[model samples]
Target: MNKVVCLAALAAALGLSACVSSSIPAPEVTMSKVTRGMSQNEVIARVGPPDRMRGQNGNECYQYALGKYGDVPFAVYFRRAAVVASERASCNLSITRATAGPGIVWQASDYAATRR
Candidate 1:
């Protein structure tokens, strides 16, 4: 009887641990691993098309935004002809249309002069 109780307790603990260990997947954003001077097409290949795109100074710019419940918004900016300039935020939680708000705007020059 003692051995059976111990086994059952161990199984319950293991089950609880398994439940707690499963974590939500991270968000999918364009320009997650972008580099400088990467063409617009390359950025699309990695992160898919942006929610919206704009042109400035003859360069194309893309903006990717993700917002999740109980988490701050995530935004990534890509220059028209360059890789990601900088990540606006660090939130990695999954975002959805229902949770995501307005689109973010990225400027072309901001990424044009970036070294790396």
Candidate 2:
């Protein structure tokens, strides 16, 4: 009936308003709790789930939105299932390629065509 529909709509609006009123913790505060050498599980437990993930070969990078409104980029790198580095930047795995040299070499470009 019309009464039931109105009641349902009011309840839905109230629920949504409650969700919007809740506060989100600052990204820096959360990211600070994560540290290098931590396992993936530990990282998740400390900072909750990542917003996105990228990987190439055996390496993985978890990306999260930074800033007060979650508009900036942040990334945590993992190698061999362990945390290797954390940076206030985003990375696309395709930007890197395996070199036939001794150690890993990162190109000096922030944006580039993907390597095949």
Candidate with best lDDT: 2
So what's the TM-score on candidate 2?
0.59
Q: Which pairs clash (backbone N, Cα, C closer than 3 Å) in model 1?
A: 60-80
Q: On a 0 to 100 scale, what is the lDDT of residue 44 in model 2?
A: 85
Regions more than 4 Å wrong, model 2: 1-21, 56-58, 92-116
What are the clash counts of all predictions, listed in order?
Answer: 1, 0
Computed on alpha carbons, the lDDT of every model, listed in order, comes to 0.48, 0.69
Instruction: Give lDDT: candidate 2, residue 10.
Output: 100
Instruction: Please provide, for model 1 over 14-96, each residue's C-alpha lDDT reduced to its tens digit, 9 standing for 90 to 100.
Output: 99999989864455333345666666677678766766444433243455554444143334433335544435554222221
Off by more than 4 A, model 1: 1-31, 56-58, 67-80, 89-116
Supply the global lDDT for candidate 2: 0.69
| TM-score of every prediction relative to native | 0.38, 0.59
**What are the per-residue Cα lDDT tens digits for candidate 2 across 1-116?**
99999999999999999999987887778778878889888988888798886654425678888766788788887776678778788855643222111244444643222334
